[model samples]
Target: MGQAWRDWGGVIGVSACALPIVVALVVALSRWRQKRGVPARVAWWRSAAEIGAVAGTLPWIWMILTPGEGPRQVHLVPLRDLAAQAAGDPGTAVAQVGGNLLVFAALGFFAPIRVAALASPLRLAVLGAAGSIVAEVTQYALDLGRVSSVDDVLVNALGAMLAGLASRRWWQDDVTRPLCTS
Candidate 1:
């Protein structure tokens, strides 16, 4: 936990400090939407979801893109790095797996609430995978001294799918059906 904080404390600190700005943005956007005739509940939720997604996601992205100490590594084999990590220290395993899972969790949790197209868990998984792929590729291209692993993608997608499932009740169901007469 101390080591984890050392690694992520700066990003976490900045995010915490920005909480007020995030809240203000959410409130401002909600008010604007309400003024535009949207229902208050819908406006508040949509605005909060949008702001929360960006606010929660950007810090993780910043951390992922930050350069590391080790040589740049690529582990294309699925589960290879995860197995190694799991076989090593338990704390490291949890942190690595947990961090990877959270890479897109915010987007998964909040995007569906704002966009009906992204309401499905499968879609969230795919989106998370795609986003992870981009991050991995970027890490390699930038020589960030990070391991680009397929397991990271898998875990990230799993996290997103799980988060999407958690937020399913709040998802925007835009489907409309004609009245049926019996």
Candidate 2:
């Protein structure tokens, strides 16, 4: 079980990071293709991307919702001495937190581009912030294997904002035309 969580964490971390972006791109591409009335090599790719993203994040959804057997235990540790000192490599903990934050950020920035948002970065930030809260709440409630941390929340928001800002390029007429037609 411990081994599974560890492996699953890595998988979730990666999927949570990648799936959002994939979903956004595929949806945009597919919508454009449909509008053009062409049935090229897109439907399969769209389905594959959507399925991959869903498959990747499902384990995380399960982990967050299922209550485990033991009573909950909360530990307070200084940020500098978390998973690393406890497991003998604080560097790893910091890296993991950073990675998770970026994952959510990418989701925040890209998801809007995929579905069309209010066209505001602030709105994107709010969406990202809300998502972070949900994940944190899940960790707190599940008490299964994930630690609810403030650093994680901050990192996630940072990622979302960055992604949102970067997505500005997607709105440009030149890029949009070629990407949609292709």
Q: Specify the highest-lDDT model's number.
A: 1
As for candidate 2, its clashing pairs are 84-89, 84-90, 105-159, 105-160
Model 2: which ten-residue window has the lowest total lDDT?
A: 171-180
Model 2 CA lDDT for position 67 = 57
Per residue, candidate 1 scores C-alpha lDDT tens digits across 1-182 of: 79778988999999999999999999999999888777777778888888998898899999999999999999989888888998999988998999988989998898887878788888999989999999999999999999889999999999888888898877744311111334
Residue 155, candidate 2: C-alpha displacement in angstroms: 1.4
Candidate 2 displacement at residue 50 in angstroms: 7.9
lDDT of 2 by residue, 1-182 (tens): 47545745775676668767777776776677667764544443433334443454354445444554555544444354234534765665655655655555545544444444424677766766677678767767757655666555555666677766776765332322224445
lDDT of 2: 0.55
Number of backbone clashes in candidate 2: 4
Please list the Cα RMSD from the true structure of every candidate, rounded to 1 decimal place: 4.2, 7.1
For this target, which candidate reaches the highest TM-score against the unseen true structure? 1
Error of 1 at 41 (Å): 0.8
